[model samples]
Target: MKIKSYLLIILIVISAVGLSVCSYIYTPAKYQEYSVGVDKEPVMAPMLKGASAGVFPWSPVEKQEDPQSLAKKDKVAETKPEAKIEVVEPKSFTKVDDSYFDDAVFIGDSRMVGLSQYCPEIDSRATFFAKKSLTIYNLQKDAWIDVENGPKETIFDALSKISFSKVYIMVGINEIGRGTNEGYRDAYADVIKRILEIQPDALIFINSTMHVTKEKSDGDELYNNGNINVRNAALFDLIDNQHIFYLNVNDMLDDGEGNLDESLSGDGVHLKGSCYEPWHQYLLFNGVVD
Candidate 1:
């Protein structure tokens, strides 16, 4: 009976020892140092299940965001309203009568001289400061205009002595082969600046260089309708539509294919005395009132 009792005691001691070992192995790593006498409170193990049950049991799990959801959020943040821009329209030309040019002055080369001599209505009303070979380059330098009962003077000098409401300029035909398009435009701009200085209140009209006849354009390389178009394009850039305006007389003179009407001009460059009526009519039709 004593041996049996001793055997039972030994079995109970072994069972208690096995339970203590299993408890130590199953405890979380943070709680492995826990003791009854330690002043530090025990940290509770985080509840974990499924795939994260045994791994990193004490650490907080980070929530992962979906890529599509992140992209949607970014797209929403980027959406905004587009800004609007205001555009201004250019001024349009209106028709006027022959009397509209009564206070106007015409300035140009030989074509202008022809207009002065041939067009009786225009000659009767408007003043002319034109010569046979006047150019933008020599407009202010050369003393070309022979003032009636006055000495021959530059166009600017003559203009300064007179008060005019409008000034019409058409002198690029003589300067076609002289310089580049930009050089011609700059010189023309300088002439306009000087004219504005002399006639401060005068509205300036820049007439396009008229096209040459098909025969003239086909025969010459530099003096063709294509070259005239280039020079006119350069001059068109100078118009402000407020004080300066472009008058495309070629609208009345050009043939269907962009050459001067064969019936209108004799020399392919200058219009006939009779054809000056259409040129004058163009001026009468395209006048700005204000």
Candidate 2:
């Protein structure tokens, strides 16, 4: 009876061991997928969220990402940086000398005529295409200039015939009462454009119309300093400060009240012959080197 009891115990132990071996060998398809190379050592199963911790004890499962999200992240990482932009400022003016006007041309109305005649140093150095009643409105169209030893010719024709390094222009005074400020500015701009086409390399100086005397401005509404200022403001818009410039001679000639000094002019409109010396000096001091 004792031998039989021992044999039954041995059989039970062997059956338990055999069942454990079969359970491990015939693993489920899910477990078997991760059971590669299990003979060498126990292979760790992929850990998943809410999975039993007792099942896989080696490492945590890597979180899977959406293909679109992964692609977007890769795109962001590979993107190129934006390019930088550059800014440029307008050019500034510098002083020059008498030799600067050696190849220069002066173009305008009576004031420019006065400049050519009275400013003897400048008159000798620069060429002048000026007349008593010359208007920018007719400068390109009418024959206004008397070529020395030649017939009268349009300013445009004269400009086309000669080569000049610098061009000085001041002619809004005659145009004040004839047309709208817009029309005057457009005509003036057209003349500037034409001059540029003729002398592309020349440095252009747009001299502001000289202000009238306080007595003249108070008496005449059309030819007043206020009207001159409005026209000068329009001309100021055309300067680029590089190849083109705006020189306001009124700085030197005006009284504290913005009118031409009463002492500087014999007539209310025209400067005295003696005053032209200071005007020439203003031009000399305010010249651009290039």
Candidate 3:
């Protein structure tokens, strides 16, 4: 009985020691670095199961984006649609025959000097009376005039000498400097009324006042070229009859710069021989040529 009791005591002590050693190796704190919970199963790699568990948790499998699918998305973004556009064209003026005049009267300021110098062929189908340094209505008495050669002549005094099939008039650059828009229109209408009173059957060609540079001198500044542009607009508004015509002769002469080139005129205001050449062609093309 004594021997049996001693053996039982030894067996109990060995079992307790074995349990303590197992607890230290597999306790929650031993695997705490890998976050393996007490109730959860630990995921140890096949090679690491025999060795001590590592200090990292098992990582999830990574997913990769497809390159071809990403490229297709980019291509769709680049292929966006464009907006549509439409183009429009402008209309042109009608052509007319111009051989009807026999005796013509050309009137205006210095610009008429160029008209007088154009070859006789231009007015050979007609006779011409061209006056320089003149205005539409006599500036002095503020009356309608058939001729305005200084302020002295009455309109009747100026009309006494001529009968015309056509009358070409280019005026108002001077008036715009001193007169209001309404004043220029009223005065020009009065002049046209008087001219028709004198030559009722004649065709009237109202020429545009030619363009000029912005003059710096005292003489030209008050009558700046912009004043002429204003008069041109006013003149365009008063055109009513088909027999009454508006010719933008400046289109044939301007270099686009406000000043007329010497090739166009020696004095920057008048048209020269070179300038007259294209104008003559235009007159011919438009049937204004004889």
Best-to-worst TM-score order: 2, 1, 3
Per-candidate TM-score against the hidden true structure? 0.68, 0.71, 0.53
Candidate 3's TM-score:
0.53
Candidate 3 ranges with C-alpha deviation above 4 Å? 1-101, 123-125, 139-162, 213-220, 257-262, 287-290
Q: Where does candidate 1 have its weakest 10-residue lDDT segment?
A: 42-51
| Local accuracy of candidate 3 as per-residue lDDT tens digits, 1-290 | 99999999999878665544444354433433443443564333221332354432233323445799889988988897666676533222344333544566666665665555675555566544445556765532443343455554554345556677667777765565665787777887777777788788766778887776423212476565566767788877666544566777767766666544446666556666546676555554443322
CA error at residue 235 for candidate 1, angstroms? 1.0
Residue 27 accuracy (lDDT) in model 3: 43
Q: Candidate 3 lDDT (Cα, whole model)?
A: 0.59
- lDDT value for model 2: 0.80
Ranking of all predicted structures according to lDDT, beginning with the best and ending with the worst: 1, 2, 3
The residue-by-residue lDDT of candidate 1 on 235-286, one tens digit each, is 8779988789999999998889999999998888899988988888888888
lDDT of 3 at 191: 72
RMSD of every prediction: 13.0, 12.3, 19.4
Model 2: runs farther than 4 Å from truth?
Answer: 1-86, 148-151
